[model samples]
Target: MNWDDLRVFLSVGRLESLSAAARALRIDPATVGRRIARLEEETGTALFAKSPQGYALTEAGQRLMAHAAKGEAAFLAGAAEVAGQGGPGLSGQVRIGAPDGVANFLLPQVCASILDENPELELQIVALPRLFNLSRREADMVVTVSAPTAGRLLVQKISDYHLHLAATEGYLAQHPPIRALEDLGGHRMVGYIPDMIFDKELDYLEETGVSRVQLGSNSVSVQFHWVAGGAGLGILHDFSLPHHPGLRRVLPETIRLKRSFYLVRHEDDARLDRLNRLAALLSERLRAEITRQEGLS
Candidate 1:
């Protein structure tokens, strides 16, 4: 019944590791283990199954988790209200889960500006090429290429960005001239690994009838760099082109691809004023940044 115990329980359940929970909580692993034990004893049920693989929640733990999450959300909401009563500046941490391309090329300047404006605010960008579980608190918010179909979530379209086959001037000069899409077949291609394309929108090369990539990576930053290095031509974001002056779009008029970024957040978080403000600012800045960068590209 203790809030402290429930906090520990939630951390362990989400991370599935006592050590990781301890590190996140800034406490020792022994303390986290003791808290979980006390929680289990209070409920008179084993909350987790122990094995070499780490803790797996028991049926009782699963039930407790749902209620505990609601409590945690309420508690955080109250804290935010209290903190915001004194000032407009945001405090505390906000973590974002995004695909590498956005995280790497776009969020740096965007988040930097946010941090500069609110010195008390902290941001963490988790660059991963997989879906984030907002229910488990993998991230406070997520920027995704596609809108999620299921979840208690709010989705907003931030902006529409373009991508096209791009290569360095040096590479284009050395390789066979690409007057059209079919001419792309004569040159090496760098792109996403075929089977590892997690989102259908990301299967950009597929549109060009490129069945194979001469160099493939799941990370957008990697593919962008490969193209920048003149290793091979790849479908790259228009926003990213400003970073490499040597890079030039190939068949720009014919091969332009459009994609949109969606901002996603848990519906429960809508009650928090600070998050609402932050999300608004984030969306506005992202939209402007994409437009500004794409103009330069």
Candidate 2:
């Protein structure tokens, strides 16, 4: 019935945890729980179901999802318009999500630069190996491997980065030999676990012509480091692998794969000067970083 209650509900629904919502809202868990209950009472239906895994939206809650989003968009649009009228530069929390590899390797530098410029802003990085839902407010901004063909959001290709089959020099030394592409099949390889890949963009292993995996993980950095530690061979990003001296590209001329980065932001955020500025900054830095990696490699 109240806008404040709807705001709290949106936060709770997005986070699915009372404690998390409280922390994000700068309030107490009991308050968040009470407000959610009050909202349910006002609506005359249960909003969320509690389970060991945390709260999940009920059927009633699902129906309110779009309306809640509309409320959020209205609020954000108003905030952005007010912000543009004049204040300190972008001064609100901005959450950016990306796969673990990009999160670990790329976003730190980008975030630092942003913070340096917009000192008053709060930046949160959701560095996980999952697909973020922009519509669900899972992240205000996201760096994904592929662009969405259908979404009410702004899409931009960050860059086309290259990956190559590689193994630790130590592993190469101790292993039998790798003269050609076929030799990869004889060696122990590290890569992503097929089923756990949350996005189709991460299904890189099937392209490598190696069916079996000696060691693997859902995190790209983990598999990369495993290869770096001489655990096995892996397909690594050119943009990230230059930092590790132990790894050597295998069949540098032959076994390279290319993947593109896509940046997606919600439609509500499109008009926000801060978010748009951030998107531009990210695109620039990403391209520059990829260039730096190119020279380093």
Candidate 3:
């Protein structure tokens, strides 16, 4: 009957792990387990089947979820409206998953700006080389390189960022000339490991007409630094180049790639005003960063 109890139930159910549920809620794992037990006892039924994989909902828990989810919607809507009345500041947590490049270069700045404006809001950034599974509740929202065509989801293309071939000036001076894409094979190339590219949109070597990678990493930051360390020519975002003065564009006119970032969330969650506001803020920041890099801002 307690709405707060439903909050615990939904978190545990969606995350499917007591520890993860606790982490998201900012509560002790023992507290989360106890709350679930209390909720099940109140309903006179076992709400979950406990296992090493964590908790799986019982038939009763599944039935209760529909109404609980509706309650959650109402609660979030009320919170959003109330927060708007006071000001545009947000409360509660938002977890965003993104690629290493954006996460390392952009998100920390964005989060700092957001936190400055909203001291009460909580933000978690998961920067990984692999794709985040939104369906599994890995993140409240995800920034992905490509958009999915099929899903009961809300998707928006946040930005189209450009990548250019680059290398340390010393390396460029010493290496074989890349007169053309055909000449790329004569020089050492650094790139994402072919099979480790979790997102197909990140499969950039083929677009560059260069497949012979002498050095590689799944982590873009590592690859960029390796290039800066004079390892080899690499494909790096134009926006990220300014920070590495030693790294010069190898052939900006020839080897280039354009990739779009898509923000996605479950359709039902689109109703949460806090989430939408955060997404809009991120979208605005992403576009502005690209423009700033282009010297258009």
Measured by TM-score, the strongest candidate is 1
lDDT of 3: 0.83
Off by over 4 Å in 1: none
Best by lDDT: 1
After TM-score superposition, what is the CA distance of residue 282 in candidate 3 from its true location, in Å?
Answer: 2.1
- Assess each prediction's global lDDT (C-alpha) against the native: 0.91, 0.83, 0.83
**In model 1, where is the ten-residue run with the lowest total lDDT?**
79-88
Off by over 4 Å in 2: 17-20, 28-30, 40-60, 80-89
Q: Between prediction 2 and prediction 3, which has the larger TM-score?
A: 2
Which pairs in model 2 have colliding backbones? Answer: none
What is the C-alpha lDDT profile of model 2 across 1-297, one tens digit per residue?
988888888888888888888998999899888999999999999999998888889999977876888777777768777766234466688899999888887788878887898788888999889888786688889999988888678899999898888887788889888887687878888888877888776777687678888797999879878888888888888877777977788888878788899889987676567778778888888778887886787
What's the true lDDT of residue 265 in model 2?
94
> Candidate 1, overall lDDT?
0.91
Q: Give the backbone clash total of model 1.
A: 0
